[model samples]
Target: MRNKLILSVASLAAAVSLTACGASTTGSTSSAASSAASGEVAVVKVGANPVPHAKVLEYIDENLAKDAGIDLEITEFDDYQTPNIALSEGSIDANYYMHEPFFNDQVKTKGYKFEHGAGVHIEPYAAFSESYKTAEEIPEGATIAITNDPGNQPRALKMLETAGLLQNIEDDSAALTLTDEQNPKKLKFEENQPEILVQVAKDPKVDLAIINGNYILQAGMSTKDAVIVESTEDNPYANFLAWRTGEQTDATKKLDELLHSDEVKKFIEETWPNGDVIPAA
Candidate 1:
């Protein structure tokens, strides 16, 4: 909400919902891949989430991008759908939000024309609780809130399975839905939008909430605060800069450099600690 271009996650969900029912933006969109004359610079319009994605880009925009002949015009979106829509419609040059699995799912399901640049960082999913000190302390019939979207549900479930709540997970497929057989603890599963999971910290009924890494930071908590944290080893969820396939300009390429720079790595480590945000290995 600090940025003028930022939209709240709730409003983003509602706006994307309306667009799904035949209200998408029209016309061919273009990436910011521009070329500048002498003593000038190329500007690349980027779409991102407000919490960390846009924040990261803002750092590059101020600290590193200008020296590389690239200027970033960051537009923040609270929800995941708008950046892709804007990218396909040429509203922005690129986006810096989703990891590979979710990004691939979106491309596969929505048939969007997009390609990623390079890996940036991983926002590992975690299981958090206010009442329970550890996973073993969770009571039977405890209610848990998880992401309902196919792109993230499986990840949340996988985290729970790791926390010893459920099992019999066939694969890491996002489409897998649980049943009584998978519910060993008999813990009630409540599926809701990802953004709402952050509210579980203030709610007593939500014994264990599977929250995304981004929202966890917004709530002023770290992965170390969670009852169980996701393993970072070979994590497939490293978020990166993305744009239309074959449309990456020189400026966008420079973005990849700035994103992977040592400075950015230090920024991430200093900005977040205790594995709250892990730079892609």
Candidate 2:
């Protein structure tokens, strides 16, 4: 009888060990189910210029993304070329620095398989000066600085034309190039990258500098202080978000929606109240 009692006790201990293992397994499965039911947040990585593009994204990330069931990871890019390159290489899921013209040019020249959403905002191209307050104050044969990129050169030239600095421009297309005759003022054109145009503007020798609107904000320069500011009416240069073809997910669509929402428009208006950045219609 004692021997029988010993075997029964051993069997009871084995049953207890098995019961504990089963409970652990059941608890782990329950936890996994709970997680699956809650769903994971989608992450959308974006590359953008610092001033307004990233700033706008930052606003959306901080205020709107969580409710949309997604998260934004923004990578700031200072130059124009790298953002598109990063998008092409899958380093970033999307980019938001280029206007439609620039975006078209990139796809045409580099053959990037990219697609874009509607215009988000317009950073009006403006001309600035350290030596002169008005466009007319610029002297004849003045050395005016402009961007060297073909995509944006037309815009700078167009602004110059609006200032009556350039004339006889027959070809108004994106392929337009400034000729000696088009420059009626005999103004000398100094072509540089867009980012450095602000520094060129500060230079005493450079008579005028036509800078991008985003750069103006980045440099703490106000559009109200510009000698010439592009009109926002029917402007075609509104910047938008871009992504590789067929790579856009639901999260990216949600981001694009947030960018155009009324709340975003209010944020932009309040942030740059002087019209430095205008929400695209």
Candidate 3:
């Protein structure tokens, strides 16, 4: 495992430095003009996953944030845990990678007061395989891979349950962390972290694996390759711009506008049609 300590510091420093530069560049001129015309400057720190989330924010930086008189500095995380830690410690002002249930879990474990800022896009989970061309083609008895992290495990398991390969444990609301669950396919399950789940998908021993949208994009797989992908409309976990509790109203508002601006919405639509990444909106 990588050292969380070093990454945290680097993330903190990167966020602070960029926003500071943005503020110094236009702080006075914007203040003197009308709120929009004056080019007022606000500095904000945000954490995100590497592919689409960070990439989406960078798109905002280019089109929306710069014009709105806000300077956003972003820090990227590969795993899910560290960004919330950075936000709780005051290292970053906000984070944009997770949904509500996951964020709630973070607060419970890490002991921080955090709140959802703005609803961003949804990243549907996808099921992929190397041995089989499609989900239905996989033989009855095959090995499947899932994320090892507690947070992702349940989600993957739930997808399998929905696919009818596994019978979920009765009454488990958080069905992702299934143990002793009946596997009808007699499928062998291997647990790996979310980021590495794709590698497992590539293995010949692996028949199918559940992976998130961003990882699918990272692996250069298209929707055609996915045997299953999360439905955008009913997915419970809509990614949000999360901030330290009480701070959700101010810079967060601007961040929200920037994220959901007309241009960002259009980009998501055109770039990922079929409602693959539906805006919370």
What is residue 130's positional error in candidate 2, in angstroms?
1.2
Evaluate candidate 3 by giving its C-alpha RMSD to the native, one decimal: 5.8
Q: Residues 47-104, candidate 2: write the lDDT tens digits.
A: 7888899899999999998898766777776767767766776656688888887888
TM-score: the better of candidates 1 and 2: 1
Tell me the tens digit of each residue's lDDT in model 3 across 1-281: 01122233335555444334431222222232234434455656677776678878888877777667776676677657667766765656678888776777677766879888556788788888766666567677677777665555666666767777777534333333445446666667776667777788778788888887777776766656688766666667778788777755345578777787788878887877765566775
Give all TM-scores, in the order shown. 0.87, 0.83, 0.79
Q: RMSD for each model, in Å, please? A: 4.1, 18.0, 5.8
lDDT against true structure, model 1: 0.76
- In order, the Cα lDDT scores of the candidates are 0.76, 0.76, 0.66
Per-residue error at 50 for model 1, in Å? 2.0
Q: After aligning candidate 3 to the native by TM-score, how far in Å is the CA of 196 from where it should be?
A: 0.7
